[model samples]
Target: MRTRFRARPRKWGPLRGLLAAAAVGVLVFPAGASAVSAAPLAEQDLGSRLAADYEAAFLTQYNKIKDPANGYFRQFGDLLVPYHSVETLIVEAPDHGHETTSEAFSYYLWLEATYGQITGNWEPFNKAWRSMETYIIPAQKDQPTNSGYNPAKPATYAAEHGDPSGYPSRLDSGVSVGQDPIANELSSTYGTNNIYGMHWLLDVDNVYGYGFCGDGSKNAPAYINTFQRGEQESVWETVTHPSCETFKFGGKNGFLDLFTGDSSYSKQWRYTNAPDADARAVQVAYWAKTWADKQGKGSQISSAVANAAKMGDYLRYSMYDKYFKKIGNCTSPSCPAGSGKNSAHYLLGWYYSWGGADASAQYPWAFRIGSSAPHQGYQNPLAAWALANDPQLKPKSATGATDWATSLNRQLEFLQWLQSAEGGIAGGASNSWGGSYGTPPANSPKFYGMAYDYQPVWHDPPSNRWFGFQTWGMERVAQYYYVTKDSRAKSILDKWVPWAINNTTVGTGGSFAIPADLQWSGQPNNWTGNPSTNTNLHVSVLNKNNDVGIAASLAKTLLYYAAGSGNTQARTTGEKLLDALLGNTDSKGIAVPETRADYNRFDDTYSQGGLYVPNGWTGKMANGDTINSSSTFLSIRSFYKQDPDWSKVQSYLNGGAVPTFTYHRFWSQAEIATAFAVHAELF
Candidate 1:
């Protein structure tokens, strides 16, 4: 059953001192707002190790989210190198669904972002580039615009085969990432892992991330200095995109977008997938606006941004005519506040600048607390960061650069809510283990949105106030405190530290636990899933996780907190967690999960393993296979940034590509702004 640390699952015989090791001192803390820690170890240095285990788990295991074809990437079919691809990975995964390349790519980016933060370098993040090279070959295309070591194709399908002009995304099968071992565990064929449910993985970098590292890893190839597009297949040269001249646009035909492939040969392919007229318009408008903003001759911002704005206007118009129009905070059967298409409404609010420049728009846009299931209490860092850093305008004008205080407060509120005064949190706040894994009242409709809980059912629905009822609260909670030193942040700081200190034994901190960890608090119904048999295969692949979410993220927070204190004990703990994450994901001898090769799942991984390794089983895909990896292992990024000892992180950065993480900074600023920026930046 899902147990809360604050309440400690009552039957667990009082989890006393289970987190005492994380506490700075021994003192029972009170509830909410104004606070004081009796054992506040204000002067300590933990490092990026806080989230180490969880980080490693995310990177390696997340790759299994894809259903493998013939147990290898189409290109890497026969080229499976022992230590690189096959050595560390379990080959057998239950295939129940298709794997989406886009989703895998997004997950890859997520890991790179965090890894880059630890070392402040971008080279270690080259795994995404390599994936593209082996999979989509974006650089091999003749259309120069889409060049580089990036996943450009999600796999093409016949447009007329029972598919619509745009609705057949389901039929599209994307082949990316590596094999899934979960299916083997479940005795299913590799074909069970579908490759179609991964369409939304496209252009996610544009929406959220840009480059391999925080600076712009998505579209910008900062990690690799030499681009073939800029110089035409010359590894030593920079790649460039198509400047003009395109035969694909307008006209009611099934034309496709052209892109550069990564292979040495110049290539070209027609993306026959149904065109998203609206999404395409947005892309075009963005380009036009950007071009128009460029001075001196080649200014195409008007065509790009303006066009995008125009398209946005059209979409907005459609929205306004339909499920929009704000009224007084009225709750009704018809006017559901956060009902139909929540993201769509969010966009509308952004265009209106939060209600024609009013409080309603600003609040939800930046920091409206999520009071429902899935997302409860925690504010969207995106809104907060945008408010504090928007070039267009700050969410709050008066506060401006001086600071975004409210955002900071909200962060503190959420962070505090995530922690248990005794230590850790309701279930531990690692990023890998978010609040969704909690117990709901007996016979509830949902437990963190899933149909069934993993453990035995719970007795009550999670109230999840503030941070809400979370399964992995302590994991990410500590990082929240370390990033922003809120007045009450220490309480959280103390709570997660002890957990890390006690859990790690140098090489042990990782996404390693049991299949039961699937629904961290436990699935609503006791889950008996395996790596390959379950519908989603990721959980099985990254089965033996590093628990890096909290440990790695917390390590860095601990280090920064302990920096000047010169605390040797804290330093040792930080270093231990750091090494643990590396052991968990650094397959290439580098402290980065971007090294896909060195991180193969293990033999037993056929049973289930962490970072997709050790679960160990490689089987072939048969007819009608549908299962795929469940949880993503791309979260090791938090490990690098959360440890006290960044030696390996530094070593990796000194050499390869790694993406920088912008979440903390972005979120911290937003929280600060929400609490204080609106008053100043609004005008």
Candidate 2:
């Protein structure tokens, strides 16, 4: 289900044109040029000042890209339009095909609503809401009227029948008229699309009273009810997906784990019912119930509480396992149909076998179907967050809250257990599934020219080896500490933060010190020949440079830890790291030399002009050319304006005009808008 697109070197033809256009009055500021002043604001007024700047910038870009008929923004801006056809509007020409994802739009909706709350600007919120109701929500509810078209069935329907297209198919330009759009929209099918979108809606409503859904009126309640119905329908479809029924685990008849059948990453649709997706769904359902209760519409979400509890039980009892064991031995009154064999057909079997022989020694990482290795950085924290928030998920005991606290404590302890003596946390154990630079084994499950096996347990040996860019775990631990004042969590952060600061070297220099994949056994010697020198597995080594994503994540964690422990030095260092990242900019004030180019697969010219935060400096490509990482501008936007330099970056985005730069379709726009909306007071 993964889509593989090769990156090719891009010429500066388009970029030069953009710059030339900007030189003229082609892209003047939509908002007045005076929105952002040259002088920086005082630290106390930084949040509000930056909020103004961000709002201006968002409007400029939004106006340019928004569809006139429908409020949704197109995928690519004017820069690359000629290179691609109207049908493949969002596709980065000649690479991956055209497709739009709900997550991007979901993020946009959340951003607009959040910013509106922060600034009391309802214009953006109205626009975003209108787009959602007009296009996205209607698309999910679209289905055939025939009796064969069961709303509860776990099957996909055509986008043609759906109102307002289900996916981003063509540009609104006249040249692409009358062409039918093609999309394999899974989120809409599985209910995730609605659930995720509703989660944000609930968040905005909770923060800024009811009736904020396009001003106070009965329309808000009506829309919520419609969304709730869609969400409920989608969840039913998910639990009934053939895979869920076929592969029942831990006595749960309708327990489900599946991904939206979207084609993007190499791993898409390969597994079903991912723990992260389920946990998120649980939160969405919980929030839905809470929102309904607050509005005196309790009947609207009467079943939501029970649904969330069921999902939570699945996560805790069925999915959460301390050790890998046969599905039959996994739980009391073990799964009757459990088989002790490994095959793709036997989902549980594959999971248990992949657990490796040393399961007894390992701490429980959240279990994902088709694999036993814990996704420590990605899945674990989300599960913790969901479990901590929902009281219905807690055991029915006098000390139910205590049990929740204990669960979080244990999860933190597992993270601490994985921390190296040198203070770096090992990214969870590597799954036996193989996409190694080396050859595959005979029994390997062949997919995408890689092997998938369940043998040879892999864990980072106690050393300085750390997973590349695995800072989310630290962020979650810090967040837990901030909320609960847990001493263990604080202690872990106290030790790890100083160690990370020391280990992280700044500047583009001699050897790329950040190992993309650090291994202990050193079996995969494909990275650097000098793996023996470091006593850690060196999967891939990028040249020494500032990694925006890692830097931002680490800085955020440091900020959280500092807030909780009153550690002034940690706060100072965190701000310093952010300053360094914000400083990695070109003359035009765009963050330069992208480190994570793999993110935006379409534009092959890795280190081109864009507002991308580089993965690291001196990042070496496969062709022996050292280039900047790709732009994850949106992801980095949340940390915007932390320093004076960022104000200039915001100015460029607001309407300073750089024609050569291409606007990413959904993700970038949403992230940038969200980043601008971030309230400075929180920091």
Compare the candidates by lDDT and give the number of the best one.
Answer: 2
Highest TM-score model number: 2
TM-score of each: 0.32, 0.43
Candidate 2 deviant stretches above 4 angstroms: 1-72, 75-117, 120-371, 380-386, 390-410, 429-469, 505-543, 584-590, 595-679
User: Candidate 1, residues 411-496: lDDT per residue as tens digits?
Assistant: 34433333333233332111111122223345432221222212211112122211112322332333333334433545554544
RMSD of 1: 21.3
Model 1 global lDDT (CA atoms, 0 to 1): 0.24
Give the 10-residue window scoring lowest on summed lDDT in candidate 2: 224-233
lDDT for each residue of candidate 2 in 1-683, tens digit (9 for 90 to 100): 01111111121111111122123223232222223321222333211245443344333333333433222333222211111111221212121112222233344544444444433443443454444434333222221111122112212211110111122112111111111010012223233322112211111111111122212222211111101111011110111111112122111211111212223211011112223334434433443444445546445344444544444443331122212122211112121221222111111111110100111223211112223234344334434544556555442323323434444544564455444445555433322222111234443322212122212212111112233234545765676677668777777777678766665654421111222333333222122212112233222222234334345556666777777888877666554554443343222221234322222322222233222212332222111222333423222122222432344344445555321222233433343333332213235
The C-alpha lDDT values of all candidates are 0.24, 0.32
TM-score of 1: 0.32
Q: Which whole-number lDDT from 0 to 100 does residue 101 have in model 1?
A: 26
